[model samples]
Target: MEHAPMSDWTTLPRAFYQRHPTVVAPELLNKLLVRDDGRAGRIVEVEAYAGSEDPAAHSYRGMTARTATMFGEAGHLYVYFSYGMHWGSNAVCGEVGQGWGVLLRALAPVHGLALIRAARPAIRRDTDLASGPGRLSQAMGITKALDGADLVRNDRGVRIACDGTAPPPEPVVGPRIGISKAVEFAWRWHVPGHAHVSGRGSRSR
Candidate 1:
């Protein structure tokens, strides 16, 4: 499918995210996720973790230093330090004050694979590159430095671009993995049968 020319990401308005959760999740697939390091990638998988209403959502507990980004303006980056070692990236959604985010679970490399590999040499197979949230952030050089950066424009150095290519029809949604709560929500969305989807059972989830 043809893609939109690269342009500044215009933060999606509040109403855009207020729509049904599942609808927004798969719509994000195939969008361009570009980093300042000249490395750009495509979002292949995502998980919509809703507001406090969703037990599994981080915002379920209210505001904290780590989750504050999730509550901010729409289209902002909500990055979090995890596992005492890596960072995960999410895109804040919903109304300005509602505190919702769409977790960018995995990416399909489209540009700068060499740079990604140089950063994470342990990723030998092509499928492993940017296959998980933490790994994708590290591989793409997304860190605290980029926390709260605007995804709507390049002034902040990195931004997501709409490629105009709709995600494949029939994305699969199921229980989110590696979470303690809301596991029953079945909120994760991924390409139906893509090999690069990060986790085991990705096809099922």
Candidate 2:
């Protein structure tokens, strides 16, 4: 079957991220994250972390080489290494010098299954392939090198784009999992009952 073309789909603008991270997180649920290698995923789960006030946020302690991306313009990548092993990726939001990040918790692969499978060979089921932040980053070939990459530019190899569709109704909102500080905030959001949504076992938000 021929897939419908994505002609009407537009890359999300930088102004779309001018809002707070919590506002951007849920709206990103049904959007598309496209990679340079022709792979794409429909965002299913995310967690928002506000700058300065959020104890769980990296920028809470102030900016450093590792967190400089989060303090830049909106619509940039904020990739980081976790536990000295896996990589987790986030989309930086809010104004310059003010920080906010939306952790990409999970996604449903919508295009280039072959590429995703190649990137994550151990995944037996497609739904499980990108069902966590680290897994989503690994499956999409996201690494520390993409830390400051622009996610909204039309000519960029990686971008947060649209597929001309709307989000599902009734997204589940919950506290961010796997973080030790600021544990009570209900910043995590996910598509209700999506098989691709990460489980409680995920190591990070």
Candidate 3:
């Protein structure tokens, strides 16, 4: 299927992310995150992590080598490693000096199910292909290799692009999942009724 034209990086100004975390979180759903392999994945869920005030956000500690990208220009990809076994993806937000990030929590396979399944043979169902942060990263072939990459550029072969579709209606929002801090932030956002949303309360919204 023909996808929507990609979003221009220039259009995503630094101020865009500083406005409201919650609104930006759900607005990202259904957008396409394209990889160099000619495959695209539809974002299904996201979590907002504001500046230093958000305890769960890496920027909470100020700038570190690991989080410097989150403070850079907007529209950059801030990838990190966790659990000694998985990688997580985040989108940079706010001004160059400000720290903000939008964690990509899950995805709905769009244009590369066969490739994703080949990479993850253990997945027995379509919904399982990219239903969690780690799973989505793995399925999309993302890793530390992509740390600090620009999501609005194709140089890395793993840039995020728009697929010309608006997000689902009334995305659900609740507390972020799998974190010891800022558990009450209620920043997680996802398509209200998508079967692939990760974590609990998948149906409550």
Leading candidate by lDDT: 2
- lDDT pick, better of 2 and 3: 2
Model 1, 12-66: lDDT tens per residue? 3445555545667788887778876767778888988777788888888788887
TM-scores, one per candidate: 0.88, 0.93, 0.88
Q: Which digits, one per residue and each the tens of the lDDT, describe model 3 over residues 1-205? A: 5654444322233344554456667778877777767566788899988877888888887999988888888777889988889999988876686788889988887776788888778989989888899998898898988888876656488766564577877777788888899887778888877788887774346
Per TM-score, the best of the predicted structures is 2
**lDDT-based ranking:** 2, 3, 1
- Candidate 2 regions with alpha-carbon error over 4 angstroms: 1-3, 154-156, 200-205
Candidate 2 RMSD computed on C-alpha atoms after optimal superposition onto the true structure:
3.1
Q: Any runs in candidate 3 off by more than 4 Å, and if so which?
A: 1-20, 202-205
Residue-level lDDT for 65 in candidate 3: 93
* Full-model lDDT, candidate 2: 0.87
lDDT for residue 56 in candidate 2, whole number 0-100: 97
Better of 2 and 3 by TM-score: 2
